[model samples]
Target: MEPNNEQAQGLYRLCYRLTNVIYPGWQYRPIQLVRIDERTGNVYVLAGESDFEIKPTGGYEP
Candidate 1:
């Protein structure tokens, strides 16, 4: 999928705020924004299925 500059900027800002990590440099994988229904807690990734969550494990490096 094509990168959305606005979304990318928002993601980068959020990343920096949360972890002090700059995107596309500090992160190895493509990071995406997701939305969840507060009532249902159903999560939806912004860039569709191409950008889904990968839970970090104990041995996870990125």
Candidate 2:
């Protein structure tokens, strides 16, 4: 199935962030962004077999 433009853009942006902005110093650590179910708003970040869970660090849930 082909993803829409919005989804594509989101995926690319997420990838860029993960590679550059998020972990600029960690080149050895590979990151994978998985958009589990956009229809159900299920997105995840996996760094190995575990999902990189981001806990609330005193910020908005937006």
Candidate 3:
């Protein structure tokens, strides 16, 4: 159950765009990619040494 080249590439593009929004001015690196849980539909994006957790709770925090 592995993604094909095209699927992988598309996921990478998606990760890049999402990361750019969350962390402005981010340039894609070799480690960046999107991970999904096929059963739960949970998506995670690579960020630094860990994956950026997408949480539903929203508000401005600084």
In the predicted model 1, the residue pairs found to clash are none
Query: Which digits, one per residue and each the tens of the lDDT, describe model 2 over residues 1-62?
Result: 34445555555554555566456653333465554444544345574444542222211111
Off by over 4 Å in 3: 22-62
For model 2, give the 10-residue run with minimal summed lDDT: 53-62
CA lDDT, candidate 2, residue 31 = 69
State, as a TM-score between 0 and 1, how close model 3 is to the true structure. Answer: 0.36
TM per candidate: 0.31, 0.41, 0.36
Task: Provide the overall lDDT of each model, using Cα atoms, as 2-decimal numbers.
Answer: 0.39, 0.45, 0.48
lDDT, residue 12, model 3: 52
Deviation in Å, model 2, residue 20 alpha carbon: 0.3
Clashing pairs in 3: none
lDDT of 1 by residue, 1-62 (tens): 32245444544444454444454544333335655445543333444224432222111111
Deviation in angstroms for 3 in model 2? Answer: 1.1
Ranking according to TM-score, highest score first: 2, 3, 1
